[model samples]
Target chain A: MTNAPEITGETDIAPPVSSTGIVAWMRERLFSSPLNIIMTVLCGLLVIATLPPFIEWALIKAVWISPTADACRAARGGACWAFIAEKHRLILFGLYPYDEQWRPLLAALVNIALIVASCMRRFWNIRLLYIWGIGLVLISWLMWGGVLGLSYVENTKWGGLPLTLILATFGVGFAFPFGIVLALGRRSNMPAIKTLCIMYIELIRGVPLISLLFMSSVMLPLFFPEGFSIDKLLRAQIAIIMFAAAYIAEVVRGGLQAIPKGQYEAADALGLSYWKKTGLIILPQALKIVIPPMVSLFIAMFKDTSLVVIIGIFDLMNATKASLTDTAWKGFAVESYIFVSIIYFVFCFSMSKYSQQLEARLATGHKR
Target chain B: MKKVKATAFAVLAMVAAGSVGMAASPALAGATFDAVKARGILQCGVNTALGGFSAPDSKGEWQGIDVDVCRAVAAAMFGDASKVRFSPLTSQARLTALQSGEIDMLSRNTTLTLQRDAAIGLNPTGVTFYDGQGFLVPKKLNVKSAKELGGATVCVQSGSTTELNLADYFRAQKMEFKPVVFEKLEELVAAFFAGRCDVYTSDASQLASGRALQAPNPDDYVILPEIISKEPLGPFVRHGDDQWHDVVRWSLFAMIEAEEYGITSKNVDEMLKSNDPNVKRILGVTPGMGKALGLDDKWAYNIIKLVGNYGESYERNVGSGSKLNLPRGYNAQWSKGGLLYAWPIR
Candidate 1:
């Protein structure tokens, strides 16, 4: 902090900050270097050009509710939000009988709760493992039920935001442990094991999500004998888990590589087994360092959840599309897409923001 | 912090101003067909592949009931059905493409409804085929009727009338069933075949088309006798141009009327010379109908000659003579006890 006494007669002391004036300090921080000035001006112009039109179309001029298309149709433009009004429940709940949508809604709450708990720095331990396990079982039970006099809702009827959350959460949740195993195997002294893991990860990472979905939606049945049919949603979920695991394995491998040789040597000196050393010493520090990328992986998986719509899963994107068929809200496609985009952007942005916070917090313990 | 707030506020202000500008323009007016003709090509949207309805053959030649309507319109305008360029659209993409003027006409076996015509600014010409949602189940399920398939998982295409109609029908029948909805028609068919769902539900014609491909045995699946909802499928034009609507609508009506008069594409040229006043007027031997629609003297004759009449297109694509072997049920002409009764072209 700069300390200076008030100068009654001398001009040595700095002036106090004025509310309206463009201070030297503000200018130095915001537009100090040429690059800073350029970036600021460019970003400012970009925001100016894009933001207002989006906000105006999406919110200010958007019709929140209307009985019919004609009601929303004026000489002037208005979003015929009546499509959403009529089909919102269908999109949110899919074929899940309307009366039973509360089950999926509650399951979605569990995902939110688990996400909130996982983000707290203090809860980042063994308790998280418990939370994830319990959360998954509870959510699954609620979504696909045969209990408590609640009529069972088949997996095919599972959809909307809950379906998206389930796919992403379970995909990343199951993939994390599988990824660690695969990453370790890739770096193993046993050549056969290393080659196997390498092949699995490379093959999956090389293909697009659509092809994987096709294989799951089309090829999986051929692989399973006749008369043995797995639920379509389960098949998609399995494909996503396997696909995410391969990418997560690569991310985990990068984290594994960044660990100093001394940590392994220290564990070896203490006569620690490979599993013991990895679980206690290596994984903790490595995961801490790679936390940002891991969060990014989760976000990618979340976005990838939408592609399941191609295979016929009524995830949020599919739901939005289904609503468009309502005819009364046919022309309001732009409004509906913008709404879907906002839903996606909010989730992605918050995850990124949390990743930034975690990266800053974890940086205190590690140099690299 | 202040700068961020200022930028956000500025953006909101701009969007509000832009929206006000958009409001000044009129909505729900269709002017696309004239625009397409002015652009010198008819943009006719069809399906990527649905064998007898709309699909390309081995030679990359597009054929089918829906494709013929598109071609007939093209032949009427440019005097060659071959002049029309086909834009293959998925179900999700079809309506948006039409609304956005990406395609001038949508002749993709799309069902017509008051909501679709009014909401999308499309003027549905007339029902070309009367269809209804039906269920296709494997023989082993032993489902004798749609009612027997209660509590069964039924695969249905998403964003379709089939989805809502399935719910409405099952509820009315007091039947309990689970719907496994897919967005793509192809995927839904595949899923149904794979036993992802016990029953495949769609337009009866589509059910036949899909059932033809299922494995184990061709005869293993059976389409139930029940018809769930009325699917009055037809061709459509954008809303604004009443002139263009008349052209398309009359083209379809002339084809049906010609068939009712026992006129085939092979005999259309001869029929043009007939003493029958109604036939002569429709063939454009009379000037008023052709002149009023801004069409050539032989527009109806050209459509019939190039694309054939309605019956010819049907029999060639999906009727008893075709691979699909769909019976001429509700799609038969009005004189043949079907619901298809075209308004007199005169």
Candidate 2:
């Protein structure tokens, strides 16, 4: 009765200021305990010590444009972005004939378009396969131009970003199906097929990709009869495909294992053939589960394409290294590396983000 | 047990047959030359990137002393310098590329060595550039002589002859030094410039180029006036192809001889009419030299005309005209107190 007597329409007082808003958030999150306070202060000190100098070096004092390296050297401690400006073509198109650089630029754009289209769920059909087929053929024609009005440019002359994209795209395109086959073989009841798949996967996975590239570039030629040679780029491509297939097989196998036995039984009870069951039921679900890992592998493979530099294939990383070989721009390696790292990050980061979105989109069925 | 024995026998037979097949094809002297002619392009392996030695220019045209040697060979073979395809190869891949015929020849700044010449199925065509290992040190060290440094940290590339020479020189001088090694030239150079090491050792020409180009301030570092470890960098062809070897060897010689005769690319046509018998012989007016090498009568003339002489290549690539700006010391002609003495063209 005494409490009820005080029923006035007064607004409730705000929670203690320290327990709400950004100030409260800071207190609760950053200064809740001595350990947290110490960590926050240490992090703040680290940022203070590093950020300004980095900003000054990378942006404020950096030379964005210069006619020659001397102008960059004049800026001294700051980044020489002019080196990248002068060498961008050499880094992007590589030793491809300078006048014909447009071909590679177009080819790269086409490949990027195909990748974008493939990412879209609406294009997930036989039509996408046709698009990829046509896109690859066009890329090959553009790169090794013996047909049409395009003059012949040897694969040896193909390099830089276009080369990197070709290697990665073709590597994944070929390896995905091959990997699925390997995964199925590994899971087969036939001992011989299973053994062979296991051996291949284990053997390929056992060695580093560098060794595989070396074998293809160096040792494979020795085994061939003199004067009978495969194209160096082709050989390198095969090595990458084989190497990627091994890793992808394991990833697909993980996805296959995650599928419930009931799903398999359900397909079987529906009186579906093995191929039909795999293609319609098992594969769709298994591939959906593996999208995240598959994208991760793709990103890994995209970066790993840089390893072709060891075999002297002028991939993006190799071309960047080659560009630094210019005596005039030699000391600006840091800027060049950062530039290429950003290119790689853009590609990898997008793939990761797309994979997350895809996971969410495909995960709607499982939601409560 | 019987099956194992049979398998072993079959493997032995196959290996034997393979060896016999290989031996039968040994000394196919004109094989490479014919292949080059048939292909209409010389697949020349050059350094992936070595600045003054072999590296692509801004226009994506390869420009270097090593590249010139390959171009000269192509000019001699096809009567056109542009008929050359450059395969930029890493140091580890160069010898294999040559031995396996992945390249028609390797003009990749490879040093002439007994193991390479005799054991690796490659024959050194000729010395294209005379290089020597030397030390580069920051001037602030105030070190006048390499011998004066008793204890200094040295940055060198691993898996190079320079590394061995560094260890040997230090041990011979009875000086104690710590070695900081890197697998990449960029990292090694960066480390040296960052003061991680007191000395950076490489080919003297490379040091000059590195100082001139890579240094934040070229004046801050000095190449010591001591040259150790002879590096007779040269072009190489597979060993079984003697005709190809001869063509490559004489192509280099033609450049040197052309330099000796003062036959510049600009004056090559004018010099063709000269009455000098040696000039006539070299320029292929004599005809026998070309026939001996299994090339057209105008082979040497094509080389001199299209690719320029050795001295011109030197100046254009690594001398005063280039960023390297290295002095022509040991690389100069024999008459000029240097080691480049071409065998007589006749």
Interface RMSD (Å), every candidate: 20.3, 6.5
List of chain B TM-scores, one per candidate: 0.84, 0.89
Question: What lDDT score is found at residue A304 in candidate 1?
Answer: 94
Q: Which digits, one per residue and each the tens of the lDDT, describe model 2 over residues A88-194?
A: 99999899999999999999999999999999989999999999999989998988888888999989989999999999999998999999999999999999999
How close is every model to the real structure, measured as TM-score? 0.53, 0.93
At residue A176, give the lDDT of candidate 1.
84
Best by TM-score: 2
By DockQ, who's the top model here? 2
**TM-score of decoy 2:** 0.93
User: Could you give the CAPRI-style class of model 2?
Assistant: acceptable
Model 1: pairs clashing at backbone N, Cα or C within 3 Å: A52-B11, A52-B15, A53-B15, A76-B23, A77-B23, B30-B240
- Each candidate's clash count: 6, 0
lDDT of 1 by residue, B1-346 (tens): 3432343344334334542111111122435555656766687888655667765542234667888888888877778777676765555545544543446788888888776777545678987788898988899988788888779998988876689999998899899998888876656766777789899898898787566533335598898999988888888876667888887788788778878877789998888789988888878887677777787878888888888898998898888667567888998877888887988877
